[model samples]
Target: NDKLKFTIRGSYINNLTSKNSRVNLNTGVTWFAGKGWTVNFLNTSSFHRVTNNTGSSSFTSSYFELGINKSFDIQQPRHKYYNYTAVFYKDLNGNRIHDANEPGVSDVLAEIIRANPEQDLKDKNYNGEFLSNELYSNDKGKIEYDNIVEGVYNIKYIPKDIQNAHYESEGTEKQFVAKKDTVMYIPFMERNKLFGKISLHRTQHSALGDIPLGNIKITVEGNDKTYSALTDKEGYFEMYIPVSDYYKVKINNIFREHFTLRQESYIIKFNGYKRFELSFDFDEKARKIHFDESDFLITDEEENGNVSFEDIKVIKQTNLRGIVKDANSLLPIHAIVSIFNNKTGELISETASSRRTGVYFTSFFAGDSYTIKVKAQGYWTYTEDLYLNQITTFDNVNRDILLRKTYIDEEIKTENLRFKSGNSELSALAKAELDNLVSTLFLNPDIIIEIGGHTDDMEALSVNAKQLSEMRAKAVADYMKQRGLSEKRMKIRALSNHDPKSRLDTPEGRAQNRRVSIIIAGF
Candidate 1:
């Protein structure tokens, strides 16, 4: 009887089976590789052993078979992303773009910066500092940048080794974005395209070309920038400015042909694509610009409106006359008279008087209010308000005004003199009046005056006269000396108890006796 036992062994096989006199074992292994590749190995083994080994001579039989198989999971290729590029060239001259064969060409530095679309782009130099990652242009005045993300970018260019060369191109900043793969071009041009002609015409149909207005500097300021140009031989000048906001133009010259003919400044709103013609008319004789009368129109007219000849009725044209005098003495006071419109408060005229007669005259329209203000040295200011509502024809309005003389002393019967009670010290108010007197003497240079002191009859004649008169007279002399007044221009005298202007029996009379007087000696 022949019986058999089967056993199978392998790294990947855990069990073996046999049927119909044949056995098969399954085994497999897997390995991983880079780039998404995989490898696998499998094997099958079978073995037969004599079960009735009683014979001990039974033979063992084994069968093995190797099979190979391959399977692959394919993968697709990935797409590559591309970036945008920007290139530019700067022309150092003002003649638009650079010529191919131009000589003495200098290098220009430029930088390309990526700007985040979600954020606003700002120049790093705003805080007066330079930032990193700024690119510079090549020696050929060329700049290029690439691998820029899909967003905005700014290109900045600066000229190298060029001094005093004018530029009219867009400044260092060029704003652009790379929505898709794109190539951007930025060209910088020079600013030397300024040229223009100017002609002047007079109302007399004469050309004033002979008037030499040498290189008048004309400045155009706009968009946080300023540009200057000079007037040419034909009184014409042209200036080139970067394309930006409107420009404010101003002209300046040495000679003012007319008070209004000085360079006029205006806004030039037009773009620089076309030529602009500006005509200037100057009247040298009248020193004024002959503008169309229609330009000066009165838009509003009311009873109390501003002074406009066409707005109100001139019921009468009168020369108003007035005299300013000391309110207490009715004596004329020399002063400066300033007249103004009461409604508009505009000073219409002013005049100064040489003599003590404070008289002034000016023309005014009827039914108008006028204010006259008088200002004099050492005198309180006097102001008068007048309403001319009655005069219907050309007439003279006599308005006399009396200004109160500012006195250091009122009871003392003396002109421009003051004193402390029972003492020779001059009061502050008295010193102020004396200061004016001293100024007058200095101005005249040849004027002289007598300083006199007086006393009342209450004291003994000889003793009171000597003491009181001497003290008072010495006080005046000392004041003059302190004020830089030459002693040669003054003389002192003490009248003592003599020449009393008031009665000795009354208190007012005694007060008047204690006084001092300034008598003008000569001019």
Candidate 2:
């Protein structure tokens, strides 16, 4: 092609007529890179030698040359070129960190303006017109501008040009020195508003209309943060939230004392909407009494059903209360009832059931997880997990506990409670038996028992039978106590080799003797 060319030239000279010799060599290549541009490389070598009486000495030297040449007209002005790219993304979190879930916003119009007016005028004079100053972002939220003159510039955007009106840029504009290729990352945050209303149904199964639940508190929990708002007298509330896939909306526990909701919480998902409206209904716990329309001011009016208030029984009082009874006899019993925080195990409330009526009373704050423990002298500790979301419900306030008595001197098959040879660790079979034993001990809080360890008669097979026996017994006692049985109720005894359940003449007999036995000591 005429646009490019390559060439090489060389010259060599040598003289051999005299004792002293001289040589010269020259090589070079020239390339036509592009329009009015050329690249060249040239090398030269020289050699000289002199003959003397003692020895001959020679001198050699080489020269290399490399350069780029361009032909230009003096009338044309020199201009340096630069490239720029801009990327836009939604800033879900205001932290300025680009998270994986945040997506790009496309088709946004951006304007490039030179910061220096002199440079701007020069660019316009040289380029004729700056038509590439304004462009829209591509589908990938990127805008690429090439062949821009080297200068300081600013990239600006119009708020209305963005895809959503609720979005606002993180910065007023981007300022960069376009000395080389550069990229700008711009982030925008979404300001979404949600409006909500909370109402209460006056009567069950009837729409005498709904009354606005004033002063009710609502909370939105997500992103490891929480936002709260209160309803006005008209049951209207508004809150602004960050962009997220899901947020849990729940009524504050303070408002739960007077109302109950069938669905305790709601999930809100932002789907690129500027505004949202939501409504929730709650069952009011207010007492119903006989009253005429003239007796009080009613806020709502609807004709869903009509019933006589005289037939409705008014509840005088209500409490967080329950009854304790025997599981088998179904008779009222006296026991200690306690509530503990399920997470921290801290005691929150403690009370005793009446000896005569078997009724216990205690109160708790709503929206907390707790462990309800009921214990008696000879009954297994009864435990139930409770989450008090709404305190005004009938079942929420009424919790009954049934106590089952512990097993007394129950025969546990001893053959299944043997340990491995030369090991004090309880086997799976032994652990299973000990679990049953622990349950008995848990309910029989007043009972004291002894754990006895025995071994077969094998003096040559064992180094220290008594020590191994003691360890086996202690292992069983330790396991039971760890499972909620009191350590004070257990006593360990090592009865090695002297009391074997079977003859040690056989391996099966030895296995039977290597066992731990539970003995009832006192109650």
Candidate 3:
């Protein structure tokens, strides 16, 4: 009996219905909405058994689940109290109580923010948000919280499925001292909005060209709300505003003005020209913007479908610039510059060095010869003839001119001052002309001169012309010194008939050959 007991074994049942595999066909549709609200239209009733025992009876089961759950509040205090409710109304009075005249605002967002620690449960999820689809408020405007805990909370009214209304927070945030089974309530408010499209452009301030202006900031200041948007890549923008008062609009720091939204929707364009129109499109929405074409005006509309504004700039040509200076000092000086067109033999332009700065500037053309004459009142004239040899389009050509002091050479004159024949005495005319020369020296105290006398060939061969000329030059020098002039201001010299004023055999030649010469020595 002991050996039989140790060898004994049990027989197995092959297949039982409950012991076989079961199929769980989960088929649920979840509709996720904004602000963390979701609805699960699920059928938990679909199920079947895969395998069953041959001698056993099988069974099928199905059920429908209709439920609502809240977000697992990680900050929810331990639930030792009753559940609570929150109602959203169309309007609430200043006393924070629901009035009998106020109707319920269904589908309006209601949420409870808890101020407590959470119990970390692994399987049961709590997302920490609330929804009011319960039978207590007739399943209309109430969000009920189960397993209520003691904590501080705030109830907010959030608008959903918004249309053309201006929805703003109406100071409707209600703080909850949530006791046990209390129903909290708050008000939701809204206004109307003025919708419009804004188009911007950067047309060359001139008639030359234009381009799309993008990334420019546009701000709309209004009574109820202020909106800001940056222009897109296409230089287009739009704004949805609340009840339009006199709204002041600013476009990038360029300019600002105010406008009233009397119509439903309008279009604004910053354009370069009145006739040039930039194209855009508008859709047929409930409150759509319509642009009636018009030239850029602060307060006016055209019969056509357009809006325009003017923003222009002038075009300019290239120029040449530099300073005029004294050649010795290398410092700026006021000099007169005369430009001449050598090809046309005409004076093209005349510019002067600025007395204040001595800087000079002018424009010129290529493929032309220009004679630049730079002169000052006290300095020698500087004449420079140049050709704009290279033909190219560029800017800022530089040309600086320097002038020297003036000095005169008496030999450059055609006829020299004459004396009486065979006599070293000054002629009546000669002394008269000498009066002018002396007066010039008197007026210009800085001027000094050299005096020289020369004789003709026939007169020199007959008399001691060399000695006579020397005596004549000395005599003229003495006359000037006796006239109250400084002897240090003059130098006297003489020459024979070798240097003649003229080569012709005539009385005029002989008279010009024998003369006294004067030269500027210093100033």
TM-score of each: 0.27, 0.31, 0.26
Model 2, CA-based lDDT: 0.71
User: How well does candidate 1 score on lDDT at residue 87?
Assistant: 45
Residues 60-91, candidate 2: write the lDDT tens digits.
98999998999862332556667788878778
Runs of candidate 3 exceeding 4 Å displacement? 1-83, 91-102, 109-113, 116-139, 154-175, 179-183, 197-523
Which candidate gets the maximum lDDT versus the true structure?
2
> What's model 3's TM-score?
0.26
- Which predicted model would earn the best TM-score? 2
Q: Could you give candidate 1's per-residue lDDT for residues 420-502 as a string of tens digits?
A: 33556677777777787776556445556777887777653435566777788878878888999988877888887677768
Model 2 TM-score is: 0.31
Candidate 2 weakest lDDT stretch, 10 residues: 205-214
Tens-place lDDT digits, model 3, residues 1-523? 3111111222223336356444444455555443445555555443344454465344556656654445543444533355777776654332335788766665666555653425423315444433323232323567777755555666655656546434333454577765666876655433333233343332322111222234445676655556776565466665543333245555552111111223322243222211212223222213223555642344534435343343322223235566898889888898777777768868765666666457765554443577777767666556677655543354446688777655655431313367666778876666666665675566456667778888887898799998978877877787777777799888887887877878978887887877888777776
- What is the model-wide C-alpha lDDT for candidate 3? 0.56
- Number of the candidate with higher lDDT, 2 or 3: 2
Error of 3 at 397 (Å): 24
Candidate 1 regions exceeding 4 Å error are: 1-85, 90-106, 114-132, 161-163, 193-281, 285-344, 347-523
